[model samples]
Target: MFYDKVFFLGKILLHLSIIYFMIASNKIIYDRNNYSDKELISLYKKLVKPRLIEEKMLILLRQGKISKWFSGIGQEAIAVGVCNALSTDEYILPMHRNLGIFTSRNIPLHKLFAQWQGKKSGFTNGRDRSFHFGSQEFKIIGMISHLGPQLGVANGIALGNLLKNNNQVTTVFSGDGATSEGDFHEALNVAAVWNLPVLFCVENNGYGLSTPSSEQFKCKNIADKGVGYGMESYIIDGNNILEVHSKVLEIAQSVRVNPRPVLIEFKTFRMRGHEEASGNKYVPHNILELWALKDPIENYQNFLRKENILSEELEVLIKEEIVHEINEHLRIAFAEEEISSTTENEIAGVYKHIHFIEKKPNQNTTEARLVDAISNGLDKSLEVFDNLIVMGQDIAEYGGVFKVTEGFLKKYGKDRIRNTPICESSIIEAAYGLSINGFKSVVELQFSDFITSGFNPVINLLAKSFYRWNQPADIVLRMPCGAGVGAGPFHSQTNEAWFTKTPGLKVVYPAFPYDAKGLLATSIEDENPVLFFEHKALYRSIYQEIPEDYYTIPLGKAKLLNEGMDLTIIAYGLAVHWVLDEFKKHQFSADIIDLRTLQPLDVATIYKSVKKTGKVLIVQEDTLFGGIASDISALISENCFEYLDAPIKRIGSIETPIPFAKNLENLYLQNDMIIKEVNILLKY
Candidate 1:
């Protein structure tokens, strides 16, 4: 009985010890009197510099020396506080108004001013302005004009850190207004699903552009939404730099090891309008006066005075030094020459020369259908590269709409082979994030026609990413396209021409099973972004012997199926088959050129054929207007005008959507249409 009493007492003591330790570890590390004086002074300087720089930039804007400025006049505390929490090597994806983050990172003041002036000394070398550029060396991601997409991108970066086993947490900033964008929820959901090491900081300045938070969200605090995604959420006084710093730092210390996302909503206000051009007319005067009373810099200065670390003379001296520093930087930035129109800096200058992959002899061959070949190609690529990942709707287990990814989930697991929500724009934006972090993503768009839903990321972000920042986005978008199976207009459309005209994109379309397998291999291995189109009709219909050993077909090179001198037929995708069928029946002595890749068109082969034949006929599956056929016809008229004996002729689907009726669908871009166009070229 005495031993039992001793054991009970020992157990009670152990429980008490654990509770004491827990309380000690989480004890508040700083208070009004206990905070370090040196650190407080440093934070004060960080808070002051951004305020002065913003005021100077406004002055320059009035002088017509800078184009525009987005002032973070009232929100300096959040920027400095969050940046102070991060380690030097940790990544930061910040918004334009977060100037304190830049100053804290030692981003030179001259370069910042030069960027605003559109000068050569800027980060983008006059290619962009106003926080649209990021430094790979500094671990910062350049911001796109669209704000919310960065949240999804931050998920990718944090996932990368997790994969690398690097115990580093990433912080991304967004305004309260951006939380309304779909990308915000999409990113938070993904990060929470994966349990990533990231902190999403929302500067809830009560207004987004001109809209107030009352209209922006139905909830009271943006932090309230974090719990829905299973993340820890908090609301803090943003005007108090000490409070913001303490909370972020404490959370950062925990998340780097435990590795789950946290959302901290900094309750602040935007002192200035959206830009200098927007002069605070939309904001209420009384609201501005209320926030001015809580100014972050003024509050910090008052705190410093209470601590006896700041004096009136000292404050004046510090301001004078910063003013002189700003003037010197501005003078140097202005003296820097503007970027000239050189070959390297011109439009389309971002595209590097195509390094074509070499062809190899086919060996260990196996006969396969077009779909099987494409599936095999993707399988081999995933097996070969650890960095390669694939994502799409119903791709994880359903194996995709056409079963192209049938067994990927079981083989690769859900991490690499992912199933995403029906948010098409976020899918591509996530891919861009993955690509920038040294991972290659092969994103599948279930149907080519659905690209309209994801067009903004393709045109605005993906197509322009390389040109703006010269970063390699190694992504391949697989689009199953074309008509002939009577799936109707929406599902059966051919949209290759839409991307072919878009710069910074490589478009590839193959006809046979062998070409499909080989070209997919090439696209996966290539460094640049490629839009790969596979015709649905050819998936099961076309069959051929494909090499078991991997080999890549060179991009921007054409295959001459048959050579002749009477006429030259130019075609690609499914149209190539129609031309081949018509030629065999008519017994025409024409050179048939199959353009396997469309972007960097194989002009040499086409020109050589046209020069010998002296007549041309272009065929396409897309509509007659704004299609590749029109571009090729114009090229022939300009380059081979003398070689051509007759005016260049082309044929395509009548400018109308494909109909659901069998007879009407058959009348569109069928073999008979090519035969009719071929007879005209033969007669000429």
Candidate 2:
């Protein structure tokens, strides 16, 4: 009984000691007086100057000199605070409204003005507007207008930095409205799971456009959402420039040491409208007045002056310097010449040297199926390019769901043939990160329908990388497409049309084994990102003449499988095979044109074939309304108007959701019977 009493007293003493240590740590964390007045003033100044610049720019925008502007008026503290804390080696992914932050980072004032004026001398060579600027020299990954997408990109960039074992952090900026997007949730989750060194800055300015934050989210603080993902979070006064800067430096340092993500909620305001032209009357007056009281510049200037760290003379000198700099930049920007005709044509300069290589006769060619071709292509690519990496779910040890990437791990080792988590966003993000860091990545989406989960990374970031940053992302996204495998609606889908509508992405669909091997090789070798869609139905379907050795077929060119004067059948992927079988069975001498690439479409071959046949039938596996058939019909109708003998015919899936029933699914998808409609049209 005496020993038990002694043990209880010892436990009580230990608990008391732990409480004392926690109290001391809390004291240290909350002690603002520990900071020197000079440090506080300097931080305040860094935040105030950017706000002033943003305000002046908005004024210029109102005067019609600036065509477009995304205001960063009240959110100045967040930008300046975070950027000032980051090192030069670190990267930044800014959104449209974060121009003030870029300016603070030393982006040339003349270049910024020139971009706004749409002059050729702009940093992007007038390709992008003022808001979408990037600089490799500044270590800025660039700006994207899409909401919530940059977070995943930041995760990817941070992951890359971690892989290189570099102590650099990647910061991504977004509005409170962006948190509602699916990509935001996915990105935060992945970043937490991977422990990536990134900081997600949520500039919660009370409203997302006209919608108030109170209505959109249930959480009291945006930072509170981080708890759900097991992440560190902080809520700070965005108007308190000194507080913001100090917290940012502390958090960034913590991330560097611990290598984990953090969410910062900057409780700021949008002083101006969303854009310069917006009236902002939709925002309630009471809320506006409340936010006005917390203006970052006003609060910081007052704080600086009160501390005696800044004087009236210094303030006047800084204002004069800023005004003079703005005026000088405006003068140079206005004097710059507009884009001439030569310069307009130069916009297409990237593809000037791009030539289509003709298919050469293969002495050691052997007949194979689409699946074999895919495997052979992977083998050849690995043999040729040392940097090529193949990754996907169940791809490493299990050889993937369709075994398309079989034996890749055995040949390339674990690092190159990586197996990713089931999360689709993580897979795509990893590929994007690897591609940017000089790895030729071939990422596989388990099925075409699942690509929806990774849509933002594909369309917003990968597709725009070249056009936005002038940086080539040699990434290949391979997916098993089409709907005849009894995989049901959720698993079976042809989503090629979805990506084709997005500019800057090259979509390739190879029908035959020969074309599959050749086109896959070409896509792997190309500097730009490519989306390769492999048809599940055609994977096992054998073709007559596939080469045993490796080769490549150029993109943006069509293959004339057969020659006929009666009619022309334009098809791609599985549809091409269906049309071929139908023509053979009906004994119709129809010309068959296979569209190998969708974006840089082979208009020359298509127009030539349609003109000769004087009739066109466009067939695809997607829905009839917005399918590639519509694009083909429009092209032929516009370019070969005089040559057409009858109205163009289109064959595609019925405009309805795919049914789970086999018979209904068969009827919804195109079959050889659709070719009978072409014969009926020829009779006209």
Candidate 3:
């Protein structure tokens, strides 16, 4: 009986000791001397909401109610503090684990729950999952899976804000692992060089998946790299909610006045695994215990309670209210429709506004080279649209490698015509950011072969964003491609087929000056990403009398260059010029069709010509295998096979890399190959 009494006394003492420690351990690390009592309580509530919601999400995941959960349980302080510090008009691009950003922005709880479950009422309308969707109304942009690319996107938004002189700043987030990506460095360099108003945040959460920071990067701190990029940077304790809030709040306001990029590295930890399913086996037990002792929510609650701003009863009441609200939102989201009403699976028009619209001014004419015609198209577009921006390397002063933008810098100010560093991927990302906003951007690649470096943003982001979120990307990529200029393989490539297969992109390859000017105008007016290919050889070699006024040609329409009944010759770019020259030289009785737009191929024209002639010959400047010629030939065979007298024939460059020698370059993708192929098709 005495031993049992001693044990009960010991238990009582242990409980009392924990209570005493909770009160005594609430140290004033970051004094909240400036904020009022009401404000302090409100900040504590903000810190509590996301932790509770994330815990509930994990519970749902365990019960198999939700497919996945990315826990931000421990890192709540940074998200809440940073979001509360920014102004409502400033834009934010958040990573996957930034639930507090959505909640602090006052996004409707029900809509966010629906988005996680992919319901019809979500921001993306059941298109994406979790925090993968953004709300423009809230001034938030969602990050794609590649976290580093969003930095460049933030650059674009900040650039737009600077040009408008709205005194607004932009903020973007990423983790320590993402700092190792090339886009991270490129974005900082671009932002610093342009002096854009942006705040870049990095949360060093000890580990990226299973890999620790030591293995990922050799730098002492992620913020240290900003010095090399010529930007101001800082390091802060992310666990201190008040400190995070006060520092960011001050920097955000000051950045609006100074208008430059700043990098802030928040030293924090992910108390949970990368995702709930991944488990925290990689982290040590002692380390976890150490971090748990520094929990942001618990510490903030302790601080508030010690300062007499929050009572125990009030804290419990706040949690109860938040839990009830979340439960109600979850209940409503569970009952909401998970798909669109118009279709069983939501595949809306992947790309809209594709039909060609022709615009012609008075018949005033002037002889101009293809390059001059392109310049005229851009000059006219810039004159008409005040929000248009042109960005590329050597474009501002040097006028581009092809001199296409020669006088643009002098005419338009530096903001309208800007030169970028040798960064294709990040600039493309910036262009995408501008495109989604109320601006149309034109990005030029010095050589078409360089498209490979920027392929991800085009294919994964720009090409699919419209279908995924109904956000149109109003941008144009000018590609200088083709052989016979002796630029070697790295510079010359007929790569239209690379983008022709993409759904949301439009491919425009014009053969002459008149077509180049008109087609460029049509492309500029379209609200989708357009891949405008210009053959380097045809830039100066081809001259024609084009209308000196602003005119646009039909996008998906084919031009019937010549008419006959013997054979149908279909071509584009340099191949069209080849067929035209061949017909003039040999006087062959053939129907010549110039496919001005390669994507929405003029099926009616091609079919009619093939049916009348009973023979067809397709040509391209790309290699013989897997070119647009193959798709055109297959389509002709499938639909117009019965009308054809012989199997369809094609002429293209041999399946070999473009050579540098003048003799070899002249023979490569030569026009002489078309005559031989046409003769065989006519005889058969």
The best candidate in terms of lDDT: 3
- What's the residue-level lDDT of 68 in candidate 1? 82
RMSD for each of the candidates = 11.4, 9.8, 4.4
Order candidates by lDDT, high to low. Answer: 3, 1, 2
Q: What C-alpha lDDT, on a 0 to 100 scale, does residue 112 get in candidate 2?
A: 77
What are the runs in model 1 whose C-alpha is more than 4 Å off?
1-34, 343-348, 352-362
Q: On TM-score, who's better, 2 or 3?
A: 3
lDDT of 1 by residue, 496-577 (tens): 8888888888899999888888899888888678999999999998889998877788888899999988899999988898
Candidate that would win on TM-score: 3
Q: What TM-score, to 2 decimals, does candidate 3 have?
A: 0.94
Off by over 4 Å in 3: 1-28, 340-348, 354-357
Write down the TM-score of every candidate: 0.92, 0.84, 0.94
Clashes of each: 0, 0, 0
* lDDT by residue for model 2 (1-684), tens: 999999999998987676656444422122245678666656655665666666677778778877888788778777777888889768887876676577668877888788777787776666677667556678676656666666776776787777677887888888899899877887898888778898999989877887889887998999999999999899987766667778888898988888999999987788777776775898866556556656767766776677677789988887777778878878888898886556555545432234556455468877778898988888888898887888788998999998987888887887678777667875686677666556778988888888888887788777776665576667889979888877778877888889888776889998888888888998888877789999998888666677777788889889998998899988898888788888877878788999978877999999988888898888888889988889889988888999999999988898887777888889888575565787787797
User: Per-residue error at 665 for model 1, in Å?
Assistant: 1.6
Q: Which pairs in model 3 have colliding backbones? A: none
Q: Report the C-alpha lDDT of model 3 over 453-508, residue by residue, as the tens digit.
A: 88888987788777767778889999989887888989889899889888888899
Q: How close is candidate 2 to the true structure, as a TM-score?
A: 0.84
